[model samples]
Target: MILAQILHSLFFIFVSYVLYLKYNNGVVKPSYIYSIVFCGLLLFVFNYFFKGLSNRLFLFLLMFSLSFVILQFMKKFVNVFGNNEELAKRKQLKVNVLSVQDFVFKKLFIGLICFYQLLLIWVPGIFEKMMENQ
Candidate 1:
């Protein structure tokens, strides 16, 4: 289980890094990509640590701490990115320039990455099923 959680966390981190690269290359808007990556990392860490807590009270405390970290990250991100009108306009222009297919593909790719991470963390049985089905 620990190995599975580690692999899942690594997978999420890799996917988020890919998104970060895409944003840097102007393939996607930084605001959305950064937000998504931040959230993904938070979820990854939450799942990783949640499995280690044996006591319910400890688990709840860990979850609360994770929530606080997530909230603080978002607040800081918004402070840096949200109040900048120029950046917002530029990102909007970039988004507008994306083709429908490109937009759909990006969304689908992120969805798949997130789903795979969740499956690895919460439903290893599903992975076994997929392998059997194959």
Candidate 2:
């Protein structure tokens, strides 16, 4: 289970990095990278810290914390990219928008990876008991 968790974390980190690179291309500023990485690490820590907590209240808190970190990252991403209208316009002209097929495929790929990790976390004894016949 520990190994599975480690692998899942690594997979998520890798996918997130890839997503960042795809969105930013080669023009991402260094400060933005630092901010994004910091936010990502915070999310990771929050996730692992709350993994064993089963109380609804604590779970809600953790979820909120995680969401906050992700929002911070998104804010930085938008501030760095979206605010640069000239750069964004130039990039848009040079690069094709991701095709619907490509977008859907990437979404499915990431979703499956996340779902598989969730299954690994819940299998055998963890969440299985919740579904057992009474």
Best by lDDT: 1
Q: Candidate 2 at residue 54, lDDT?
A: 32
- Per-residue lDDT of candidate 1, residues 83-116 (tens digit): 5567577986545544443444344545554555
lDDT tens digits, residue span 38-114, model 2: 64555556556755323332233234334434754665566443455665667754243334434443444444544
Q: Against the correct fold, how does model 2 do in TM-score?
A: 0.27
| TM-score for each model | 0.35, 0.27
Error of 2 at 80 (Å): 35
TM-score of 1: 0.35
- RMSD, every candidate, angstroms: 14.6, 14.2
